[model samples]
Target: MNARGFTEEQEEFAAAVRQFAAKECGTREQRAVLTDDNREQHHDSIYAKIAASGYLGVSIPEEYGGSGGGILEQVILFEELWRGMVPVHGAGTSHTVAGVYKRYASEQQKKDVLGAICAGEVMSISISEPGAGSDAAAISCKAVRDGDVYRINGQKTWCSDAQFASKILLVARTGRGHRPHDGLTMFEIPTSTPGLDIRPIRTMGGGAEVNDLFFTDVEVPVTAVVGEEGGAWRQVMAGLNGERIVCAAQGLGMAQRSFDDLLGYLREREQFGAPIGSFQAVRHRVADLAIEIEASRALTYDTARRVAANEGAPEELVRATSMAKVKVTETAKRVALEGVQLMGGYGYTLEFDMERHLRLAIPATIYAGTNEIQRDIISSTFGLRPGRS
Candidate 1:
């Protein structure tokens, strides 16, 4: 590791990404045009530029036309982009789906799926049905095995970027087993598959990125199954844990940005004929926030280091990741809220980026397993159970 616990190569790569962000969407106006003045969550023109920069393949292996980097590089990309205010909403999901394909896909599947992703096409995960948000094992989306294919019929909600993605990583129940988690399978299905519908869900965040995906008699070849047919529960669980660091990286960046904006406001905004930061109470609050942001940075990078050192994380790392996810995300939300309160009406306006930060931070706690779930995981790892120590 080099400066700030990143390797020298990673540091250089982050500088390059920062420069790319500065050149592309460095200003709020540039980002606004890319996102159509915040009405859109994704823009093809900007995303095409990002793909051309090869940042899309930062964590993907080189064999499949990627940059052959690892988790750390992906974290840098995510953190720097968010810090620079580059709104590539699809990058997170696409990066995650590549990991799935890398881990479970057959050679041909990797060549096809990962190739498309590296080539600038995006991917979305199809989990979280109407009844299966937290309890993913309760998935009711059924994919029954037909003669030569599987016929899928169900609706998946809260699927991000499904409308614009070239592929979707779907989790559908194929059978029943001892536990609800068993007998589920993962599938890679093209977005253009028959009997599929994508409907945009208007959210308060002012983006049409999330959607509901409907499948009626959608048929996929039996070969589309990823990993074992009846063993996707384990696959999905590990995958979620693995992606926790990604969220932490993103949250840390957001929190830092919020604090930076707040600090500048406190220094410049005058009240009682002096800068508000000159007041002891305001100074104390700002100091507290600074400490919290620093703590979040430490926790996130320390967890990343442990994960990198382990080659792969042990089962215990689940709790570590859960802790990092909750701390970073909750801190990010708090910073945004505090920034809004301190900046008064200015923070709430579209003129400042604080409201956008708040919009993005609010969902981090709820999605990808809620903060409550993260705490539960941490507690359970401490041996908490029904009538147990």
Candidate 2:
């Protein structure tokens, strides 16, 4: 293994991905042009190029025309992509969909969807609704069974990539179960469905990466149900391992990039006729950030390895992944903020990548099951319930 603990082949793959990003969207000007002034984080052309390189679905199997790598390879790809600041927004959701399809989708659906995804198509999962963010099971989006299809009608907010996604893995309530997580089912609906309306939600990031999807009598065939009629909760729960790992990997790469930029600035930026980094106070603060970044990496990779080793250990993975998600994302936010503070006036300007990094990092803690929710998951693993039992 290399110093970072990756095998020779993995290291070579990482280097190749880094070079790809450097050539595609490495510089600020190049990224600006590709992303249209930071407005399109998931630029179509750039994503198509990444697909052409066979890296977008690196975690998928070779039978699906993917790179035939595993979760670890996906982690490496995410780190290299974000470290080089490649603005591809579709990788995380694509891999998550790939995993879900592998386990639950029908044979025909798998053959079609997996091949499409590996061929550069984008897909998104809609679990959060207007009233359900942390309480995902609270989704009220209703899908009623008809003769040959399910007529869906509800509003789903914070649906990332819905505006551009080819298919949406939708979670809708079908009936009431003994518990909250029951009576739910997943549907694979095409974006072109007549009654499905997608409204973009613009954030400070200005990428329109997320959207509010409204389904008005949207009809999809019975075959659209992913795994079982009322087994959607199990399907979603089973995919959490890779989902949380994806978040942690993303934060790891972003934190490293922010720290690198800050250190470079400190070394060259002069104050009191000497480099600002030479000051004890500045040095100490930078040292703390460096430590935090390293700690985040260790936690992320360790949890990843453990999850791989104990593939089916759901309970252990729940605790480990929740902790990793919280730490990595929180640390990413802190590191980017610190970079901004260290750079002072220059950091906030659009000319620097720090501002963009901050934009990306700020939401890391909110999405993929918010950091607060993650903490609750971690604590629950210890037999400690947050609210009164």
Instruction: Give the poorly placed runs of model 1, Cα more than 4 Å off.
Output: 311-313, 386-389
| Residue 43 accuracy (lDDT) in model 1 | 79
The model with the greatest lDDT is 2
Candidate 1 minimal-lDDT segment of 10 residues: 306-315
lDDT of 1 by residue, 1-389 (tens): 76597778888999998898889887888888887787776777777888888889987889998999877787788888877777778888988788888888899999988877888898999889999898887899999998889999999999989989998999999999988688899998899999999999988668888999999999999998987898788777767655898999899888988998889888998998999889998789888989998998888877877776763446578888899899999999999999998889998999988998899889988877899988888898877955746
- Cand. 1 TM to true fold: 0.96
Q: On residues 100-178, what C-alpha lDDT tens digit does candidate 2 reach at each position?
A: 9989999898888888988889999999987988897798999999999999999999988888889999999999989
Question: Candidate 2, overall lDDT?
Answer: 0.89
**Local distance difference test values of all predictions, in order:** 0.86, 0.89
Best by TM-score: 2
TM-score of each prediction: 0.96, 0.97
Q: For model 2, which pairs clash? A: none
Worst 10 residues of 2 by lDDT: 307-316
